[model samples]
Target: MLDTVCGGGGVREAWGWWGRTLGGPVTGPDGAAWLRVAHSPVEKAGGKLWTGPEDAERLVPEPVPRPRLRLVRQWTDGGDAYKAELYDRVAGGTLASGPVLTDAPSLPVAWWSGLRAALGLLSAVRTERTAVRQAYLDRAMPKYLGFLDGGGPVPTTAPAWSTAHGDLHRANLVGPELGILDWEGWGSAPAGYDAALLHVYSLAVPETARRVRAELAAVLDSDAGRFAELVVVTELLQSAERGDNLALVPALRRRAGEVWRAFDGR
Candidate 1:
């Protein structure tokens, strides 16, 4: 299907990183492009994940450093629905090899500055789409953060809200050039949500976590920022229950307590 769309473009490499998405680089007639294919049950194909990138392309501005989405094709086979998207190939590698950081990456100061600017610009864009729904927070926060000792009441309402790259993990962030990939969940979230998510993902490496805090302090230290940290911790704890990011569970719990103290104290 991709070959039919690419019109004889040679596939450079192909790999399935996420559960539902398969993507890699291809040398097309126009130039190098990334081809991503996602599959879903026919009944569930029209949901958010299926259409997020396309919506983001139409809604988000170009200066955000995300690759330009060029073409998309959708089709169904039996009970399965498939969609393919081709985007301009971005240069440089992800800040970390995967979603979680194990070591501190030596990023240029300019890269950090660029990230701050990109996130700020993104937050200013108006969008009706929501990344973190209040309903989910109302339901998930108490259920997950309930396990934390000394953790006070979980606040379902955010101090403020803004746009975010909902899943702002290391793997989605490319450095040396600063590109944010995986737009499957970009929309309105609690203010500082992106920075908080990045910090939590960097906890395994203390230096990296500290660097994230120091670099994104303006957002991470605010009332919304502290709340955002707990929000992220709640989500990670829930993910840990499903056996994902198991190693970070302890850190997430500890961080949840710390954030709650600051959140309640302030």
Candidate 2:
């Protein structure tokens, strides 16, 4: 399949959920392209984004100037059993060289610029549906509001909502040219939601977190942004209690404390 879509020289070097990714030099094309093959219905939210090129192109607006998807081919059998999308690959490397981050990382100016452009555009734009909703943010799953209530009233209300990238970690972004990969989660969410999520994820590296906070001060310092922080912290706390990403528990707790204090201890 890799050879068929990307020509013979292509190789399967990367992989994703329920599928594998192939990328290599495109013969006679003077460049490279990518292919993703997925099987059947991906019940997970945002699963459909990978199966159709039109969906991505329609949902993610042209925040061009930034490294993003340039669709080449999108084909499916019109059944829930098979789907695939081929995209023109970006020469720029991802935001982080590796998949995981534990230390303070340095990002180039292009990365910052691309991030600002893409996020700024999306933030102003709106989407009808988002995986992250008020219910998901304040879910009763491991309960954080109780603690914040200090044995008093714990309001389950949320703040103003806006468009969000849903997931915007280092792994999903590219650098040099600064490309933001993966648009499955792109939709309307809390205005400061994406920034808060990025900052929380960067908590393992204080310097990086500080850098994000400074660069996105307008979003992170506002009431909407602070509410978004609480949402992410609550989600992380639930995951920690569930024994997932336990290594990040300490950092998440610290982030939660900071968010709690910053949000008037709400």
Candidate 3:
């Protein structure tokens, strides 16, 4: 399939890796491109996650430090559906080795400056598409926040709404170059949602987490940003219930309490 996508250019077999989705680097006549393919049940392949890259290409503006989508192909086999997306390859590696930051990364001053600018621009874009739905927030916040001490009853009302990358983790952040990847979930979310999500993912490394809060303070320190933190923490706690990021559960709970205290002070 990749050979067909690249018109016979070879995919780098030694560079391939997989997680929730599978992808690898490939060489085409024009240049090198990253080929990502996602598979889902046929009935489940019609929504946001399935069409995210194409939407990001059409909706997200340039100079945002993200790989541009070039081509997309979709096919169905029996009960399963597969979608392939080809994007311009980013040069530097991700900020962290994976979704969760396990160690502090030494990023340049320019990288932090670029990230702040990129997120500011992205948040200002007007879009009907939603990265974090109000309905999901309403449902998840009450249920997941209940898992934390004194987490229940934190209102889910967002002070403002803005475009977000949705999944702004270390793995999705390309560093030394400052490109954000995995646009599979970019759309309208609570203002400051991206910054809050990044801060949560960085919690495994205390210094990195502090850096995220400090670097993105314009958003992370706002009323909307504080609300966004609760939303992110709730989502992660829910994921933890499924045995994902279990290590971060304690930290997440502690943060929830701190945020709750801030709200109490208001």
TM-scores for every candidate against the unseen true structure? 0.93, 0.80, 0.91
Please give the distance, in angstroms, between residue 234's alpha carbon in candidate 1 and its true position after superposition: 0.3
lDDT of 3 by residue, 176-212 (tens): 8889988877899999999999998888889988888
Q: Model 3 has how many clashing residue pairs?
A: 0
Residue lDDT tens for model 2, 1-266: 65665546536556553343433333234345555554444343135355333454666677633333444454554444444455567766666543235777677776786787778877766556564766765565237645653534433466677777777777776666667666665677767888888888888777888899988888899878887887777777786677656777777767666666767744
- Better-scoring candidate (lDDT), 1 or 3: 1
143: Cα error in model 3, Å: 2.7
Which order, best to worst by TM-score?
Answer: 1, 3, 2
Candidate 1 residue pairs in backbone clash: none
Task: Write the number of the candidate with greater lDDT, choosing between 2 and 3.
Answer: 3
Q: What tens digits encode model 1's per-residue C-alpha lDDT throughout 79-105?
A: 999999889998997787677888889
Q: State which candidate has the highest lDDT.
A: 1
TM-score of 2: 0.80
Query: Highest TM-score, which number?
Result: 1
Which stretches of model 2 miss by more than 4 angstroms? 1-10, 17-30, 42-53, 64-80, 97-100, 149-155, 241-243
Model 1 — which ten-residue stretch has the worst lDDT?
A: 9-18
Q: Give me the runs in candidate 3 sitting further than 4 Å from their true place.
A: 1-20, 147-152
